[model samples]
Target: MKIYSKLTSLFIVVVLLGTLSMRPSEKKILIFFETKGYYHESIPTGVAAIQLMGQQNGFAVDTSRTSEIFTDEKLSIYDAVLFMSTTKDVLNEEEQNAFKRFIQKGKGFVGIHAATDTEYEWPWFNQLVGAYFKSHPKQQDAVLHIKDSKHPATKHLPKTWKRWDEWYNFKDIQPDLKVLITLDESSYTGGENGSNHPISWYHSFDGGRAFYTGLGHTHEAYSDPLFLKHVLGGINYAMGKK
Candidate 1:
């Protein structure tokens, strides 16, 4: 009777261990916000959208202040990093090196709105962002032309969608960027003579996927259902889900 009892106890322990080990772990994504920016409201709204998407897709979302986080070790703990409308020069030398290494290590990154206006002094970061902010024609209602519909980020979006946001002109765009969406010159004022003003794009640089969208300039933009879906797709695509 003693031997039988001991065997039953061992079997139960083994089964319990197996069940615990079989449970899936949640994926985590980190969001870094540069709080020293003009468009503060938009960033928080964007973060909320990201959190909603994370919950829907079984991901754990983490957020940090720009001046407090962004160490190499802290960054490694996440599968993806988001630069949410940050416009300040918040990163020091050590942080920049860490960030560069982070991308080289094959992770994911997303840049929204004013992210292009940041890190202008850092040449490598400028290239990573795909373009630097030159100027905006004006704050006007614009139409975003889906240049690459097959791309996971823009795939679900309509061919031409109307949105109200601050359109930006970027300077010294890197040649290798895979342009995803452009602003339709006909729908807005203030673009240079060229018709193709890239508003959103994604590229793999330094062994990691990087995505940037020039939308999200206003809180209203983030609340829009269609805009939220677009942002969600971009985040998932960057994380290799879409």
Candidate 2:
């Protein structure tokens, strides 16, 4: 009887260990949409699209508009942080410090359109975003030139993709960035960056990965398969999955 009890206990331990070993690691993302300046009307559509992507891709997403979730304990729970069209100064000094620490700990960051328009006073934040939104022409159709076809973000896109959105002219463009897409100034008027205008880029910053795209300004962009693929690739790249 004692031998039987011991055998049962050992079986239970083995089963528990097997279950633990078979469990997959969870991937979680935080989508922060706080805007202090001009808010995009497409913000809700963007959030919903991202949530759907997360659901389909087997990752978890949490949305927040408040800076209170920027603490170390809170930020630590997410594998990646995405700024879904966030603008202006959104975090206080303490929260900013916590976010800096979070990035330094090797997490990921994904920024959509107008994220570059944020935190002009914080140099570190600007550097992480890769560029600042200098100005933009009216929303119009433009040709996107794929610079890096091998990049996950541009792999599925054509060499010359045509899309319409609020086209931004960036200032303080990071010289070391791996640009994935550039805009052909000839295809659109009011382009201020001349011929070598970059529209999407990614790079490793500090101790973390950062990806930004000057896309997703219009509600229709979220539903476009190619655009969705582009955003998904950025998200995957930021999460270190691509």
What's the count of clashing pairs in each model shown? 0, 0
Residue-wise lDDT of candidate 1 within 10-115, one digit each (tens)? 9999999999999866668888886554656667777888888789878889987654566787887877788888885868889888888888888888898888
Candidate 2 — which residues are off by over 4 angstroms? 1-20
Q: Which pairs clash inside model 2?
A: none
lDDT of 2 by residue, 45-137 (tens): 999999999999988999999989999999998988999999999999999999999999989999999999999999999889999999998
lDDT of each: 0.83, 0.94
Which has the greatest TM-score?
A: 2
Model 2 earns a TM-score of: 0.93
